[model samples]
Target chain A: MIVAERKPFDEIKNMVSGYKKVLTVGCGTCVAVCLAGGSKEVETLNAELNLAFGKDKIEFGAETVERQCDMEFLAELDAKADEYDALISMACGAGIQFLAERFPNKPVFPAVNTSFIGVNLDVGWYEEKCRACGTCVLGLTGGICPVTLCAKSLFNGPCGGTNQKSCEIDKDQPCAWYKIHERLAGQDRLGQIIEISPPNDWSNQKPRKVIQPGYEERVKALGR
Target chain B: MKSGSNLEKILKAGHFAFTGEVGPPRGANVEALREKVSYLKGNVDMANITDNQTAMVRMSSWAASIICMQEGVEPNFQMVCRDRNRLAMQADILGAYAHGIRNMLCLSGDHQQFGDHPQSKGVFDLDSMQLIGMVKKMRDEGKFLGGADIDGPPELFIGAAANPFAEPFEWRVHRLAKKVAAGADFVQTQCVFNMERIRAWVAQANDMGLTDKVAILPGITPMKSVGMAKYMKNKVPGMDVPDEIIKRLQGVDKKNVADEGIKIACEQIEEFKEMKGVAGVHLMAIEWEHKVPEIAERAGVLPRPEV
Candidate 1:
């Protein structure tokens, strides 16, 4: 899921300080689960902002939709969003950009910073899982992604930096190659580790439009 | 006579080649660098100029290699994949070659977090293997990584590093073989205090015929003191300082600890000389460069074979 954290109050305050009437729009999806832009979080932020501004400094209202990135949910905001001088989006970066595009005339500001595509480790805890490097080598590396975990993104073998299964960068960070070696060894698949991996093609990093396999023709037909 | 380096000549002559390491000073103190280089001059066939070792900022290897050359000492210039992209890597090779550097060692440098600048960005566009392959491509095929032509290719005697004592012990020999296959002409193993493990690793490499494919130089570091031994054992990444060696260091008197360390290093060198598939010894007397000559002499590798 897309993990995000709320921006510091000072920065958020500064962003909406100029507006007399502001609506805090929160997403009900990824950011909500991460506790950044859910309805409860939006209400808490609004209450805090109300306390800081007293009643006269700024007028604050809060609303949350099923998903802010989707146009259908954004259409709901479009109906009542016209009265506000500005908007504070408590969603992932994609949601903030879509909200801005939907209400282009109004000033749309982000209330949270979208971090990475990650898995929720525990309540309010997250760890990055993938870098979207386009080409995946997980199958070749015993399910560990060296592209994301290895500090140098080394492909051939572990560098001389693997010490006691820890990375040279931080003792807490496990060495990706060491883990790969262990996993491959456990599966009796260590022979493949010696095979040389050619340099990755970074051309896959260019902004891509990936259409779901079977829906490509239908999408193309519906497109301009 | 690839690159025609003196080290290459000595190894090719079937003599046990000797090499020392010189870490460039943090600042551009050319005089200090010259003094350090002088310590290894004429004592070893070649001296390796380290590239930002420990990820600490220092004078670059190529620049120090020039200084070593000017001081009548041959340099085995080191390059790490941590700092440069492929473009910069190829450019540095051409530039360093123009400066008369003949020997080059490819490495995946120590992470930046281990250095003074912990927050620095890591630009490992290529690992050491890829770097070795790229160097070979430029040298043999006379082409750039982009498959474009090079006006003049750098004829370098390529070297790579290995840590036989590192984790997943069974993979160590195969790792070295992969490096040899990557176009490395020679290899220097990580500092070896675990003699038994290094011995086994080398034997495995011999079985795989890596000795015929590439020159293997077992690395030796003469610890300065018991504290240094403990640091290398406990703190340094990829190091395997056996407890018995540490016990030996602890057995010595405080004043005699350094001598004991030198003794241990010299013994390792003698053993490596007798071991099959062992092409040479790379002595890294860190910050104790002046003692390399003594170590080389006591180890009976001196007079440098006149190659």
Candidate 2:
């Protein structure tokens, strides 16, 4: 899932400093699951902000939607748009962007730092798993990602910084290429690690948008 | 005759090669660089001009390499993928080639967190392996990475770094083979303090016939003090400075520690020459460039080949 973390309280406070009435919108999907921008978090932030700014003549409200990325769920804020001077979006970058598109006139601010697409390792611990590099070589790498996991993102093999099964950059982190090597060796596929991968095709540049033709055709045929 | 570099000529002639490093000045001043290169002119075959090494901003390696050429020494231009995109890298390659830089060392640079500007974004559009392959493609195919035709591709003697002390130690030689496959003409390793580990890695490389494919120059850094030795062992990533070496350094008086370091470096170089498949010793004197001549003389790599 798309992971995110709350921005510092000072930065969040500064973003809506002058706004008299502020609305904090939270996403209930990824951010909620990560315990970052869920309904409970939104309420806690709202109460904190109100307590901090009450003497400064400011009011705050909190609400959460099913998924901030979808326009359908975001439409729930339209009726309350006129009640607040500004809005704080506690969601991933994509959700924040979509929220801004929904409320063109209202001042929309992101209250979180969109980290990466990762899985929860444990409670409050997340590790990045994918880079969405358009090309996936997991089949050859034995289900490990050298692209996102290796500090150097080396395709052919690990850099000289791997030490005792950990990365040389940070000893706490496991070396991705080492893990891939172990995985491939376990499967008796060590030969795969030596094959030279061609230069990465970066044609799928950033801010990328995709359209599923089959889904689009189905929607069009349904005439909905 | 790739790049017609002296280093390449010496290695091609089957003579033991000796390369030295010259870090560009932190500022734009070239006098300090010239002074450092002076010590290396007759003592080494080629000098590696570092590119923002350790992520600290310095004069571009391209410029420093040209300065080396001006000082009558061949330069191995070091490039890291941390600071530039493909367009910038290609442009610099053409510029460096035009300015007479024949050799290039491709590296995945140190992470920015270690540098002065930790807040900066790293532009690793290509990893070191990909960069090596890209440079080879440009030179051999006479085409850019995007397959665009170049009027004249940069002819370079490609070099890459290796670290024998890094973990999954058994895989080091295989990684070196991969680099050679990616188009490295030669390989220079991280500083060697653990000779046993390096000897094992070299033996593996010999068994795999990798030593025959690419020239391998093991890195040697003279320990300036016991503190420096401890720092390398504890702080420097991928460096394996054995505890015995640190203890040896501790045995020396503070004033004689630098000499002890040089003595150890000389011993490593001598042993490196006898190792099968070893090409040369890359003496990285760091800031003590003045001591390179003495180190080279003591190690018997002096009177460097003129080829």
Candidate 3:
């Protein structure tokens, strides 16, 4: 679901201008799935860089690790750090930070812009969804996420911009407000749009520096 | 044949030249293919004999090229490297040379997964670029891909595929340049329906100096039906099936889709004839080989060059 885009070649070239030996590392996770920073893209980038700055001008290296997010993956690179002058990470923003943390001395440049977590509409196409605001509002909005659709992410009521059951911003697509109205209308509770709800508490949901636990905790406890 | 030989003659022959492709018939059945070539004798300048097209098991390209030559049709042998290793590829180059298949089109064959034999392991020991380089090495240095000396190399008029509408269009142009650098004499692109995209590609090719060195033949295929057009747009990679073409097909009566398809294809061919950097058109009708002459005639691509 993670969406990313490759940085332009000119910028990438400038980043590795002084480096004699460069390792272009690819992540086989979200970046790979989005086709931005996959193994093939890494190899192509390597070939292009070589072709641009003659093969003799740069001592280039390339590899793809399992996942740049995990410490285990970073540990695998311990044996080959000396062979590279700098590292270019083709992973999300978080994965790049993790790599930078692991290899403090080496300069690490991001090869992709971490766009958003979303769904692929077609092959090689993706649309943004779920801003990851550290809160879940699906219970009131139904399974169809209004957070990504709403012009203002207003959980309280339907916005005034809903025209002819379509969003004013994009007329081709349905309005989130119209959907909430329909849901309320279906349940014989048409007045739900007018129902006042308290504003979302921003103080209690401050961004934290650490992700305490993910899916691994359940697996570790089960020992499967 | 000397330097700048077969292709130079072919390119100069110019407009209205007809060509047809023969996907070598599988198993001990050369009769059908030979007959197809014979039918094309008075109509076409060359018969593009394919090498195991669609990843289907078939007669070798060199074998088919030799058969076509014997049948009085100049064969533009299509050679793919999906099934062969570097050794086999190099060996085949020499073998095709011995059999007199000078007009060679290099292809990275269809994946085995798409074919009936999905279990068969694909040996992509070298991609299209590597194969082009290997051929150039053999022809220019009189040596195999392995740096070993050869007695003499075949004089190959090399052609490679250019997929303009492939994802990341810039990369396709880069790939075409790489093929050119690898000594590709000409290019035959994937079926082009979107003329705007083709025009852009032609511009990029011109920018890359490919126009001067390589003759680019944009591949064209007629839309048989609305369903077939939809299927192709959805399934075929490197194919640009524009909306107008779809609407054009949809406007036709159900029974007349084939004729409509031919009309559209002929229009594209005619338009492409005047396009800059476009040397010719490579018509791929799949199984509908008979319509090629009609399409060519309609497109005003007439009078096959004197053989």
Interface Cα RMSD, each model: 1.0, 1.5, 23.8
Scoring each candidate complex against the real one, what DockQ results? 0.77, 0.63, 0.01
Point out the higher-scoring one by DockQ: 1 or 3.
1
Tens-place lDDT per residue, model 2, A1-224, is: 99999999989998999989888999999999998999989998888888878845788888999999999999998999789889999999999999999999999999999999999999889989998888898998999998799876767777666677888678898989889989898899989878888767765586675658668887778686
Interface RMSD of predicted model 2: 1.5
User: In candidate 3, what are the lDDT values of residues A1-224, reduced to their tens digit?
Assistant: 78999999999999998888999888988889889888988998999889988878887788888789898998988878768889999989988999898889999999889998899898899988776765566655554555566644545433223344555345576767567656755776544333333324333246564435786787779675
Cα lDDT tens digits for candidate 2, B46-117: 999999989999999999999999998899999998899889999999999999899999998888878999
Best by the DockQ measure: 1
lDDT, candidate 1, equals 0.90
- List ranges where model 2 is wrong by over 4 Å: A218-224
- The docking category that best describes candidate 1 is medium
Query: Could you give candidate 1's per-residue lDDT for residues A18-78 as a string of tens digits?
Result: 7899999999999999998999999999999999988798999899999998999999987
Better of 1 and 3 by lDDT: 1
Q: What TM-score against the true fold does each predicted structure earn?
A: 0.94, 0.95, 0.57
Q: Write down the TM-score for model 3.
A: 0.57
Model 1 lDDT per residue over B1-307, tens place: 7788888888888999888899988999999999998888889888899999988999988998999999988999999988888988899999999989999999999988888888988887888888999999999999998899999899999999999988788888888988888899989989999999998998999899889989999999998898999998888888898899989999989999999999999888889889999999898888999988788889998687786
Q: For model 1, state the Cα shift of residue A121 in Å.
A: 2.4
Residue B60 of model 1: what lDDT?
A: 87
Query: What residue pairs are clashing in model 1?
Result: none
Question: Which parts of model 1 are misplaced by more than 4 Å?
Answer: A212-224
